[model samples]
Target: MQSCRNCPCTSRSRARTATARTQRSSRSCVTSTRAGSSYRWTILAAGVVAQASFSAILLGLPAIAPQIRHGYGLTLTQVGVVLAALNVGLFVTLLPWGIVADRIGERAVLATGLTGCAAALVVAGFTSSFGGLVAALAAAGALGGGTQSASGRAVMSWFGPEERGLALGIRQTAVPLGGAIAAGALPALSAHISLRAAFFGLAAGCVAAAAIGTALLRSETTKADEHEDASPPLRNPRVWLLCAAGTFYVTTQISLIGFLVLFLHDDRGVSTAASAGVLAGTQVLGGAARIVVGRWSDRIRARIVPLRQLALALAVAAGASALLVHASLWLLVPALAVAGTLGLSWNGLSFTAAAEAAGRRRSGAAIGLQQTFLSGGGIVAPIAFAAIVHATSWRLGFALAAASPLFGYALLSPLAERRS
Candidate 1:
């Protein structure tokens, strides 16, 4: 056989092989980059679904308060207690869950917690006594608390600073979206079948979300990096200030979300279905507003500035709703929708601020601490608002609720000025 080492044909064939290999390598690199870019969005979708699922239990339970009260033959105060039970559970567990997420991983925390929450909701569905129902719901809240920190930490790890605001905003929409789903479905389900059916429906959602989140979520950090030293969220005054602002903001949110249906139904004589429809509409609007505000924050490259502005707007809108309480249904509905949308819009900004303040490694803890304050507000708002309504009137109660966002705005001013 002739030696062909330097043959011209052989040279051409070798060159062809090299070019083909280069092309294949380039294609693989592009494919990898595309997959990485797209996968973050998939992670975001999973987080949204997981949060929304749990929110159904947290916020949705209040939507069917009438059924719960009637079924248990409870007073408004007792109804407030029942509604607050879930927040009490959340308050107890949020920090611990956050610490756990920072140590382990988002996937494990979200999957395990959501599963436990589903089981707890099932227990709630089956329980017949008032005390048993409260206990079951609180258990669900405690377990579901993991979703808040883990899902947020996942977003912070996966997305860069430039995109974090919009990403968190979209993620935050899960709250109103979940509430809307619950408000729209639970009342009708309870009215037609039973309140137990409502609880079962929420359980089904949690189970489905757990499965989806488990399949999609993963920790973006290495074991060592995840445990890296960062500013302690507890010691950070900025974080505490953010927490205080969030606490006040949530009171307004709960006042509208937890009681709007009741107010319209009892005070205005609107049918339960109609009142729930308004609430559902408000939630949808709020979700859309979050997306818009999030994008706006990204454009401005500032979170607290817009947050403070929105707080003022929320205060005004809420006050307007209070004033319009006895106005025509057409007038009152639109005003409440604006206020509710404003109330729901600021959360994503605060979430982004808290995570950035703590650095990515400790984002979970910061978010947890912030959410814990908000949960405390969630616990108190219903009871206080209910008491105010019981003692004086719904109009006065709503007027007072409007002041919460103003307090939040004031708390956020120093932060906003520093950012400016």
Candidate 2:
């Protein structure tokens, strides 16, 4: 009845009521995303833990190689085979894991994979037979391979383009950090306690990493932009080139990691504990190198150029280490340190270039593809280096391994002309 002139009270009341409703809706929609929202550092931490889980079995083996070999009476060739088995598992699973990460999301894939690895390692710890132990390790590698793609993908998604290189560099440090920890702990455990206990300790680490990954990993819900959505990373030629370079680089790196302790202890007559300590120091320096290179790449805004230079540097270092292997610790230590630093430092730079080239949406799949090549190299490097060592000497084997990075440097030099 009070339709027009007398409706001031009604209008004001409706306006106030609408304003209150808006405020309530806003509050209701404000979900606590702080915990779930992706931070560059948080993603980096998750990536490190996931990467560490993957490295523990492989990297730790070199530290405890003598104990395991003596315990099982395994030949150097057989030891090499066992090492290759883990890479075999990684090579088989990388691409599939990448596809899964692209489809189901990185969080689920990493959590599920790391959890499975924990179980596999537990089985490995209890197994008495060397064959059984190798099988379990291979299985664990397959299960844990998802982290390679999933963690990198998470970093690519969370960080901006300019910062991804440095972010990934920091994330990549987990691999060496894991190696350092394993180097420090595994040899002591295998020597003092038992091989089984060492494996169980590694299993426990994977379990903790899985729990952390599940809690911290965030899933991407928004659609990607045009570049990321248009072409699959596998279709990009840049990715293939990066993968090619990575394969050679990984070959050289795995050889150094796999055989450094043995070379030190056998050739230079260093104690096992001292040799493991040196390898651990190398991993620490390598980790530092990654961060420095990554930051430098960010500063220059060029990835491939630095990668080429690093490859060349690695070649020189490897060659020098080969020549200096039988020398005194004063010479050998610095040579190995330089070689390890340059050899292990290339991954972050190449990975950043590959991921950027693949675009964000397809980064998981691309990283998986590239990692497959790297894993393939890992499979071959150990066996090949062992065979060469058996046929000739550790010096010759390292000399030969140096050629790989030289080739990688040659292959990647052309990329410097193009944008990274």
Candidate 3:
């Protein structure tokens, strides 16, 4: 193996490439040593940037949903279809990408997946018809989904367990950064340029991410990091419980945060900018939650207590918000903001719980199963809400949102007892 002394602060991607060449020649499994490696930290920074790009694809289109609806003369179902297209990309591709990440190592999978997102987002930007849009979104989602699982795995490998929450929290910050950026900026971008241009901008950003990812994504010391694993059966009870809890947490999250702006505009009759501000603010609030919750998870022995407290708090917030659906247009800002704050912030904690529940050896698959459950909610909830909006109104739809957390709480409550 080439000494770290030679490259100085060489990029992990280059390191990986060099290691692979060395292994082929020597028929050995030695990974690049981390001696004198300042560049490893740069990889983490790049991972953060890549995550932001991935998040933009998920949230950018929704920011311009109103314009798209008007331009296309779309019905509620069609609007749902557009939103669903993005989530569908996320849902269907998440586990498959996880499997791939396990097989190839994170760097190769991350580079390929990001490039796919760039191409697909560009296609989505130009597509005119619904079918064309769907195809592009799915492709973007397939590529984009790989970032989360693979990135999380990469961070885990890069940093040891104690630094994990901080490292992972930095990675998780992409969720809010992407959402806040799209929510605040895309509408303005759409006003001056076309929505397509805004998408092109994101496409450009993702391309930049891909280039960095290609250079940074190499490291495969552990056997688990070298090969992808198939979908294994759930042998542990904690995995199943986490799956159930994660479903509820994500269901409440995706349904609310995903459509927070619409809920403000349609249900409360807020202005578009105000709605965007609310969306942006909600992301900021949730971003803080990821850091706070993640750090808290690190200090505490039992993450379940904090998570359960958060879940129960969310249930109360959601229930109260559900009641306030018809109070007045003015009440929604605080209601939705608080609801979003508690609703979506549980992810870091839950993911931390995944590491604890399944142990590090099986953590990737455990996380994949939880993510699959989370994404499954993305498929079902919006469709149901669309039906509700068509038949009645959003107030009833808001009332119905409580069901998932109630279910999530049922599963998550048990975690406190079983926490290691």
Candidate 4:
């Protein structure tokens, strides 16, 4: 107390304390920044795995349509019904799951849904009857629906707006990635072993994906700016328009993914394995296209413009594929590949648009709503395409399905104009 204020030792002590505090603060900041930067990528990886696992089941079943038809002694239309069952289940649950993801977070929802989906697929593998099979597939679809919204929401939360487009695009690749795997593997599994074996393989994928998600997925804490002036997702007109456009887009996707194998095999007389191989190739190309388009949107800083352009390209590609449906394999193969790749590419764009319109706070619900519309189309496209084919011809069904992207293009025009 006696002139300690002027003491050199006291001043030195204060300086050392300040230096130590600054060092600790700097270290903490570096640690936090590194964690934030690195973990988003981990979340992305987990999201991709979760999405791909479920997609293998959703899209894979259609790749082996002939086997499914032969196994169940069903006609083309019945196969459509069987394929639609999964969509029906997804249509019912996607919105609710989205809401749940917003409330409870992505990790719990993805883990629970994927685990349930795996169980349902296991039940599907055991079933021998058509009714039982449809029921099981539907159940799997219902449980698997969470991945659609949860993974998308996770991407939106973890990444900044500038990076979200590309991040989501990478996430969307899981669809084709899963489809490629299923198209290549499920058909072989069904043909070499049995249809049950294929179902079991999909179940194994779901189990692995669920484990990865549960282990790696963590909910990001809600940020204050995320909720400020945010519109309710359901009430947003832009969200609805995006959903409607996505519904139309799904028609093309389902046509390519759900029926490409059948068209190649039955119409072009390509062998099933060869047809599935074409589909697998299409999926690989589509996945690459998604990444490119996503990055393109990020560079251009306009999601809707790129989305509209892709829609027009898809329309043209689908029409070309239809025209070449019965052409020589040399011509038809590349046409179908281009069409299928275009058909599968637009989803990530629409998904990003919807989430952005609703704001991050409501991104889950917006994604859910968008997926619900897509699921509805997925349910109808197969049955309608089959019925059209049954009534007329494969060429006619392809022609009609080609028109869907045109409609999507028209619906997206206003949004693109506004964005520009």
TM-score of each: 0.90, 0.89, 0.84, 0.91
lDDT for 166 (candidate 1): 90
Per-model CA lDDT versus the true structure: 0.88, 0.85, 0.72, 0.88
**lDDT, residue 342, candidate 1:** 91
| Candidate 2 wrongly placed segments (more than 4 Å) | 1-38, 221-229, 418-420
Backbone clashes under 3 angstroms, per model:
0, 0, 4, 0
lDDT (tens digit, per residue) of candidate 4 on 68-153: 99988999999999999999999999999999998899989999999999999999999999999999999999999999999999
Query: Candidate 3 residues 44-148, lDDT tens each?
Result: 787778888888767656677777777667877777777777667777777777667766777777778888888888887888887888788877876777787
lDDT of 1 by residue, 1-420 (tens): 356968889989999999999987766543432344678888899999999999877777777877788899988988998999989999999999998998898999999999999899889989988899889988989999999999999987777667788999999999899999998999988988988889889989988999998999976643334455697899999999999999889899889878988888888998888888888888889988888998898888888899889888988999999999999999999999999899888898899999988987899999999999999998999999999999998889889989988888888888884632
In model 2, the clashing pairs are none
Clashes of 3: 4
Q: What's the lDDT of the predicted structure labeled candidate 2?
A: 0.85
Q: What is the lDDT of candidate 4?
A: 0.88
Q: Write the per-residue lDDT of candidate 2 for residues 1-420, one digit (tens) a residue.
A: 769536998889888999999986654333222223446578778888888877877787798887777778888988888878878889999999998998889989998998898899889888878799789989988999998999999887777666778889988888888999999999888878998889888989888888988988885433334324448877888889899989999989988888888878877788999999998999999989999999999888899989988988988889998888778889989988889888889898888898888777788899899999998998899999999999899889989888898788878877785643
